[model samples]
Target: MTARWKPNVTVAAVIERQGRYLLVEEQCPDGLRLNNPAGHLDPGESPAAGCARETLEETAHHFVPTALVGIYMARTLQPLEGQSEDVTYLRFAFTGTLGEFDASRTLDDGIVRTLWMTIEEIRASVERHRSPLLLQCVEDHAEGRRHPLELLHVDPSVAGAP
Candidate 1:
C-alpha cells in the first residue's frame, strides 16, 4: 500500500486584544514569515491543549481558547530550494483570551519575536505570511463565525479520541 496520506494536524490560536491580533514572527522553511501562534498537534493532546502550548512556546503567553473560529483545508504550492510539492493543510483555528506573558520564559527556536498588529497590518504583510491560512483565520474571526467549544468532544474511554 502506498503510505496512507496523513497531513499534519495543526492548531492555531487567534488571540485578539484591544484592536490587534497576536502574531509570531518565525523562520519557516520558506523564509522569515508571520503566522498566528500555531504548531503541529502533539501526541496525547487535544487541539485546545496544542493551541495553548504553541502560544506559550512561541509568544511566552498563556492562551485560553474560547471558541472555534472554523476549520480550513488549504492546498498550496510548496517550493523547497528546487524540490516542490503540492501540500494541503487541515487547520483548526480557535479564538480566545490572551493572558499575560512569562518574561522569564524562552521562546521556541526560529521564533524571533511576537507582535500585536491590526488586521490591516496583517493584510498588508500577506506576502510575508508563512501560510495563506494566517490571514484566513483572522478574517473568519473578524466575521464572528465561531463554533462553541462543545463542538469537539473527547471520549474518555479513548485517549486522543475527538
Candidate 2:
C-alpha cells in the first residue's frame, strides 16, 4: 500500500503593535532565523488555540486570536545529515490582541529571543527567515486580509471521541 501524504500542520500569530510586527529569532537546523511566533499544532487543540499557545510559549506574551489572517501552504527541501527531504506545511495565520508579557517565563527551546520589526526590516532580512511564508503572512496581515474566526469550525470530535 502506498503511504498517505500529509502536510505538517502549524499555527502562527501575526501580532502587530505601533506599526511593528512581533517575531522570534530561533535556532534551526540551518541556523538562527527570524519568524513569526509559530510552531506545529498539537493534537486535540483548535488552530486558534494552538496559535495562542505557540505565541505565549515563544514570546512570553498572551495572545488572543481574533481573526484569521490567512492559510498558507509551502514546501521546502530540508537538508538532513546525509539526505534531503521535501517537507510541506499547512499554516494557519492569525491576528489578535497581545496581552501582558510574563517576565518570569522563559522562552521555548531553541527560541533565542523575540523582537518587533517593521515591514521594511522584515523584507530586508529575507535570507534570515525560517520560511518564506513568514513574510507572506505578515504582508497579508498588513494588507488587511482577515477572515472571521467562525470560518474555522472545530467539531467536538477535535477533542477526541467521548
Give stretches of model 1 more than 4 Å off: 157-162
Q: How many residue pairs clash per model? A: 0, 0
Q: Highest TM-score among the candidates is held by which one? A: 2
Task: Please give the TM-score that candidate 1 achieves against the real structure.
Answer: 0.92
lDDT per residue (tens digit) for residues 1-162 in model 1: 698888868999998888899999998777899999998988888888899999999999998999999988888888778888878888999998888889999999999999999999999998999889999999989888899989988566435455
lDDT of model 2 at residue 58?
99
Pairs in steric clash, model 2: none
lDDT of 2 by residue, 48-150 (tens): 9999999999999999999999999999988788788899999999999999999999999999999999999999999999987999999999999999999
The TM-score measured for candidate 2 stands at: 0.97
